[model samples]
Target: MTLNRRQFIGTTATMAAVLSAPMVRAQGKPRVVVVGGGAGGATAARYIAKGSKGAIDVTLIEPTRKYYTCFFSNLYLGGFKEIEDIGHTYGGLAAGGVNVVHDWAVGVDRDAKTVALAGGGSLPYDKLILSPGIDFVEGAVEGWGLSAQNAMPHAYKAGSQSELLKAQLVAMPAGGTFAMVAPPNPYRCPPGPYERVSMVAHFLKQNNPTAKIIVADPKPKFSKMALFQEGWANHYEGMIDWIGDDFGGGTVSVDPNEMTISIDGEVTKVDVCNVIPAMKAGRIAEIAGVTDGNWAPVNAADMSTKADADVYVLGDASSQGDMPKSGFSANSQAKVCANAVRGALTGSKVFPAKFSNTCWSLIAPDDGVKVGATYEATPEKIAKVDGFISQTGESSDLRKATYEESEGWYTGITTDMLG
Candidate 1:
């Protein structure tokens, strides 16, 4: 049976819609499967399950039993937090009626509307949400790969990586060198690498005072650039050297075996090297065939994928415009997506999608800076409406207040995401 391309596409679209309908499932309740239990996935699953009142079946799949948040992980290096401070579990979601599955989502069969697990089964769903966060771009850093991570830890994913990097930092010889190969733009947490630099500097000042910290940044300017520079000058003074693109910081390579880094043509031996490479959406997004090579394009209104309406992508994995890929942004987008998904399945009252995000970075003790914005769903993307940032010359009291505010937000958000 020969069919025209248009006819075949149209026929498949109709079949997909019919197969994705809620009534087709044997459970009789519409099923939503969420992958990657981070800020976005956890919040969305919790919201949907809590809001639907058992009218919808919600499931969350995550490979890790204890999820470690990348946000605030820098504090652990600076001796401000313990690893347990950022770790969370899925018990709250399970208690909230969400079917929490501790397994990896290996494949997504959109036509069959089922998610394949790494364990051994497939779970059917009417809708699927992916918020798998950032994975490093392959070969983004020369002479570096996952195999070399033990020597030059990225620590970008938190957990063991963070611990490894901290151990290396602590073991640096007196007056030794510490170098960071910062990632390029459009990566997760714009200010994250810089914050890590600040935290590292704070640690060196207290423990290994003459030890130098150097940053090789691909971008000429970074998030809160002026503020970070101001804080660095005030606190760490001659302890840090920042080499941006103008100084050949963009061209970098690392030799993990020799504990050396080459910036432009200058090879220098360092005691510890933190290499953060360019990033892409998590592997699952690409596996689902919804990514535009690097990230999954999502509609701002509901965080649904442009490729398939039944599939949604969130957080660092989603290419939604005007929002920096941060935990706050993910949590904001998740609520909007959860409301829309619940409304779609249960005919509940859906609010207009309004989103907001605030990212806070601690420069030193009681010295914190922040940037934030509110966003609205435009037809094209999630467009920024208004924004704010902490000033460079802010008073110490104001800075302390800002730091305290961030602490409060951390406590609030963790509970919000987990419970």
Candidate 2:
């Protein structure tokens, strides 16, 4: 299928195969192979590599040489940040003694514990960590595929497609229409598509007041709905249009070459179209027999796969209940999974793992909204204990401060991921 930069960044076929591959290793140190290097995989690889202090051999398999985060990509579209500000390198993990492999993983030999590489080589690991992230459902959007992505960019993963979307915005006519197809529920970043619409609207309001944005969402209610609606009315009234599922917001097909999206069998042409299809765990996860439905089922405490004892799955690939698949959640799960893996390898006492996640979305340059929750592991699942959402009608100054705080968090998280 046609993939945008964001979707491209989250691809994990190579990593999944690596985790399931079987091979022989010299008996010296335990070898850990981490697949996918966006948020969770990169964090786990770095932490395990550094925490073990050469006691463990860590090899990180990722298709890309660098990572671009989705967290602050909206800011880039709004002209509040640069692409360079959101991009990160794997040098930090390499410095931590991680053997970083920039190649695709094609298959895994679970019987032999070896991972087949696209380059015709295999790597054996004692323990495998899989964090390949999510993938788009192929037919979720009819007539849309990899070839169509060039004309209509999702910018979901936050790299080259992000740049393409930005360029499209810059080149659009003053009163052109920008259409966004919002995915169904249980997808990554519940508030993401709305936040993106706001950011794009923010840019147009300042530069091209006559321009407009339209959101076709399959869900009637969304994360931070009240706050976003309020922000749009107060700051960008008459500039944005939202159609809920009940109002035929669902997209049935898209012709990227024509810049047209079909909603409820009606064709609508636009200056720019961003189609985000339904998604599931990366394909490799499905192929390796780790996924239960669309995601991998794991032990709540350590995120080890229920289907296989030697494998651990985290991030969007794992079925983490009530926790939206955001960068923060992925990073948090990665840290916990890393600790559990270390404990398992060294024969240390394992602790009952606790995890937390916070997602911040900008409604305007200075206005932001946040949602967070703390989770505890139950026998059956990860259950939420305490959580908070941004208080309604908060002061503009407070929201602005929170926005700054979110920036600091982005910096801290990226450092934690690579460092």
Candidate 3:
């Protein structure tokens, strides 16, 4: 078989199974094994290691050497950000005295509190953090699965998939129709699909002005719906169309072979389809028996799983309430989890858990809007205490400021997660 440079890079992106500079821990340090290394797991590992200052033995097991942030990937699609800007490596985390293991966590023995790696090894952990991120539920959309991903890229998880989707968009024919099969609620980035639509429109406006966008959304109202809708109409006008649940967004199917999507019993052929299907906890969380079918129900105080307090789940894989599944939320949750884990292991002072998340979406160049909230952990869930969202017709200066703020946030978050 022949492979191009991109394919070669993707395949070789993950390091060899054998960890080269094995960590030698001092006697009886509390062991923390982190599975998955995106915003959630990476932040947890880094914080646990840095806060402890050699007091905790932290091992981060992530298959990929570099993780691309799902945040601002839409900006990459919109040409505001570069691919390299979104991708980060574990080198910084390792330099901070973390044991970064490039290997897939295949299994978990909850009773033994051990993680099984695909590289023929097991890691014993006093505390385990599983931030495996999102995985599409099989058959979530009729006639769609991982097998059809090539034809209809989800690109929800970043890295190679994001690159592939961008390539597909760039190759789209002029005046072609771009279709999106938006996921149901409780998925990562509540505003992500709409933000994607705006970015795609931004690209098409500059490259192929006549191109159209179609969104099939299962939800009636989404985060910052009025803001996004107002922006779409003001900017894209007739170039964009959305079908909500009232119009059969809930009963939609796609056939990648035919390049057709069915909505409300009407089938339309589309040139490019981005199918963001129903999502669930990462496979490893389910394998660990920590998930309640779809997501790991974590205690709001520390993001610890109900099935096992020793195992914590974060990011899109977790079902903690009030906080939307977003990079900001994951990073916030990771801090709380880190403090709790540190106190449990090293007798360090633990603070009360407080969380916050802000989701920013760009409609056009320098035109941005945001929704954010602060939360306090209740006995049942993370309840929202206060919130704010951009108005439908905010000033251009404010929008530009919001966009600028998001840029700074992207930089801060990547550093927090990777380092």
Top candidate when judged by TM-score against the true structure:
1
Off by over 4 Å in 2: 1-26
Q: After superposition, how far is residue 370 of candidate 2 from its true place, in Å?
A: 0.7
Count backbone clashes in candidate 2.
14
The true-versus-predicted C-alpha distance at residue 76 of model 1, in Å, is 0.5
**lDDT of candidate 1 at residue 364, scale 0 to 100:** 99
lDDT of 3 by residue, 181-209 (tens): 99998899999999999999999999999
Pairwise lDDT winner, candidates 1 and 2 = 1
Q: Sort all candidates by TM-score, best to worst.
A: 1, 3, 2
Q: How far does residue 294 in candidate 3 sit from its true spot (Å)?
A: 0.4
lDDT tens per residue, model 2, 196-229: 9899999999888999887888888999999899
Q: What is the lDDT of residue 338 in candidate 1?
A: 97
* Tens digit of per-residue lDDT, candidate 1, span 130-246: 999989999999999999999999999989999999999999999999999999989999999989999999999999999999899989999999999999999999999999999
Clashing pairs in 3: none
lDDT of each: 0.94, 0.84, 0.90
